[model samples]
Target: MLNIQSGSTEFWRAWNHLLRPVSSRVETPRVKLSRRWKVLAVAAAAVLGVGGLPTAGAASAAGASPVHIRFSTGGATPPNEMEAAIFSPELQKKGILKGYDKDYTLSILTASKGTPQTLSLLAADQIDIGTLGFSTIALGQAKHAIKGGFSVVVAQFVDAHPGYGANAYMVLKNSGISGPADLKGKVIGTNQLGSASDIVLRAWLVNHKLDPRKDVQFVESGYATQQAALNSGRVALGTFVQPFEAMEQASGKAKILFTTAEATGETAAIAVVARNNFLKEHPKAVKSFLADWVAGLQWLAKPENRTEAIAIMSRITGTPTNVLGLVYGVKGKDYYRDLKGCPSAKALQNGIDAMVKVGDLKTRVDVSKLIDASYLPYPC
Candidate 1:
């Protein structure tokens, strides 16, 4: 069993700092590709100083240095922090993750502020792989913040696919707010200003003929804190995903007003994106990572592994096992994840178009240019 207290206090403090919202007024400076690549090469050299650098083909040789990959994830569930659980030592010992500590080693970065922060990290070359939402992919491309643009390699999770769990918008059961119109003048809580849930909330309000800007107020509250925000009447409505949603519903004090699916159809809410240069320089390692990722998902999906999987998630996230058991890895109860690591281009495009329709984005992005599924284990 994994120990929940294994993480150091300093690590958690840094993680919490990363989770805090980035100020809109502060601009994230973008580094040129050449400079970024030079920095990475220097860092690699520093690590392999004594042995000298080995060629890509020699990566898996005995005593060869492993490729260092920094991966950024947002939350502690299927779409986000699954990599952490999947790559845990326990799972690796069970052979669920075959690539770890082989040709590549992973450093998981927490982007609790969501894709926007991930975008910043990617632009600065702080993270090699990022779990990005459709909106951020489009935004990054439009702004040229991501050097060669986002090269999506795998699907993280799909939101509101058929019977799968969707992000929920909740309110106190006795709050008497039944519909969008009832939300007028009320304070709504969102994980972040441009997060997927926030975009869906705005779109839903517009569909109901209410102007999101004028009809309601939005407060930036973390997902972990949203339940308390709702209970204390700090915010009349709050957006929830996974385990948090399950916890709130089980309490019988909150009720779902609507879901992401109700606002917009199925969405490619999160997908694994790699820096173009990283994909080009480490194709073999990339392939190994994807293969392991698919294998991990398959292992977690098996009924026999359900209990162990829940325990792993609870340890990583500090969520109760019962709460995680309620939704984690349970088909139709958890978000839909593709076993082969193929994300739906159509779903991603639809999500981008929805953002444009809501006036959140000024233009539509060509989904084709943003995705490079050639690195996936299977065809996208």
Candidate 2:
């Protein structure tokens, strides 16, 4: 379980500042690869069998109309309730894990790239629910990028102080990189441009007294393509979450330069996002979905459930059990992963404040607007 401490004064200051009017919107800049790199992205995505969000919807099967909730594993990682319940037979007995719901059927989407693609799908009304990076959705909401009123449903994994958990940036083992100072003028690759990986990397740079805007360049690649790009010498450094993060390190090909926690304490969390209209349009269906979601989290939080949990996630994601265990997240220890589907306001605020300080977000958002807790009727 994560220690959901209150936000620091800096966070409140930033939040309050957002209450005031800003003269202009200062958008964080991202490195755009050339047309050649675009082709590379296509080829890499094809090789991985991943692409933009899926457009799969289902009609009523028997009696109750099926509510389709589309969600993706961020960067095709993080074994959240959506992926776990689909594979875990024990969780299936609880409800959603069985992969068949009386009221809801999941259309699990694959995100070849990162937040932008998923956010676009959400804005276009393509996906009813999305598993998105913490800052991605917050900044998107700040810009009114989402089409309707959207709220965070749960936390997938959260940013914590260094060493508390894993969300790391790695460089090829032989790549002459030691620390943040070494990254100046080098190309740092991450999944999404404006997502947690980007924000934390920039924060890490600034904290080390290097100017992220001038000192280094960011290479954008999808999670699936991240490893290929890193090993192929396309990017000097790469940032990854969960399975992929461990996968790279295990290959003996890369070593950890830093983690998000190391640079900026406890930033970058993942959550389920849903538009208010969808919640209202299908209240009962959404309620049941939330129920299943919580049940999945509960199943994961138990220590004895680890073996089955790993097997289920491995089957669903094709990631080995060793890599998948990190998502289960131990209780009251140095290690923690996943929010068990619930995240706190303070943790989310900490990430937003980091972005605001970094100028990644032009205006501070009313965070309350991004959360709708109605779906979870009781405390998990």
Candidate 3:
């Protein structure tokens, strides 16, 4: 099971260990090229910013080797957790993920800091694909923080769409904090300062005429620990995503104060992004991966697969089946995912604009230009 307790040093250590490459894990040998020529070729490609070089797909077609793709996820939740299905041998056996070991191999890395950490990894060339939030996309584009930049290739999940579940802000049922007005001079817990949830929280607060910087104190806490922090009076409000939200609501100890949808209507909370160089160099492999991704989603959406889908998520996230069943794949109780793997440019643009209005972003970004929908399984 994936451990998402990001506040723990041990978790970071384990995560970093997983990021290191192991020679034995290489799926195939490189093409027969001298070391000096290979180094020169790489240097020339880097200097020229060219994309016509042999890619994983081209090499694999020539019976060489499949491409290795390192993808990042924030935690064990939809659609982050659901992405594990793309790597499941069971799914591959059933032909749900038809391209798993053919066109590309996948390594799903956990980035607890969410988009910021993912962006850093992209800049460092440590990750090939990352699930990033709208605010992070804006920040990266505006600052040009990543080499070759990145493009939104597919949708991870959409928050607060009609008939879909939205992330919640919860407080103890009897805490007497009825609304945002009562949060003044109180501490609120967040997963991270610039995370999607945190951005929404800040926007909500600003919309309510409260200054998040001066009216309330912010404390960093993982979603796993927010319930305890709230119950112990360490924080008056705790931001929650599923299955933590479902678990907390089931406990009957907390009540929902507001939801992210109420603050920003129908936002693209997260999307799958890839570095520009990777997209340009491995277009065929990226498209094949996306095809399998859409296929996986289709397989999970089957009514007959509900039980097994829940079980798969349960096993991956270490959450009980019953807890995950509360919202996993349930219409109106889970985040919305595009079956075709196309992300909503309009929603992302709105989210970025909201961040600027809330002072969370210094500059605005044209999200449409940063999105590459041509690689999706179908038209956007």
Which candidate has the highest lDDT of all? 3
Candidates by TM-score, descending order: 3, 1, 2
For residues 243-355, could you state the per-residue lDDT of candidate 3 as single tens digits? 88988988899999999888888888778888998888788789988998888888887889988887877776677889888888788888888888888998788788889
Most accurate candidate by TM-score: 3
What's the residue-level lDDT of 176 in candidate 3?
96
List TM-scores for all candidates, in order: 0.83, 0.75, 0.84
Off by over 4 Å in 3: 1-63, 79-81
Candidate closer to the true structure by lDDT (higher is better), 2 or 3: 3
- Report how far off residue 203 is in candidate 2 (Å): 1.2
Q: What is the lDDT of candidate 3?
A: 0.77
Once model 1 is optimally superposed onto the true structure by TM-score, how far is the C-alpha of residue 237 displaced, in angstroms?
0.6
The TM-score of predicted model 1 comes to 0.83
lDDT for each residue of candidate 1 in 331-352, tens digit (9 for 90 to 100): 6778887888887888788788
Name model 1 segments beyond 4 Å from true.
1-63, 76-81
Model 3 residue 380 lDDT score: 77
Model 2: CA > 4 A from native: 1-64, 80-100, 161-163, 323-340
How far off is residue 113 in model 2, in Å? 1.9
Q: Least lDDT summed over 10 consecutive residues: which range in candidate 2?
A: 1-10
Question: What order do you get sorting by lDDT, best first?
Answer: 3, 1, 2
In model 1, what lDDT does residue 380 have? 58
- Name the candidate, 1 or 2, with the larger lDDT value: 1
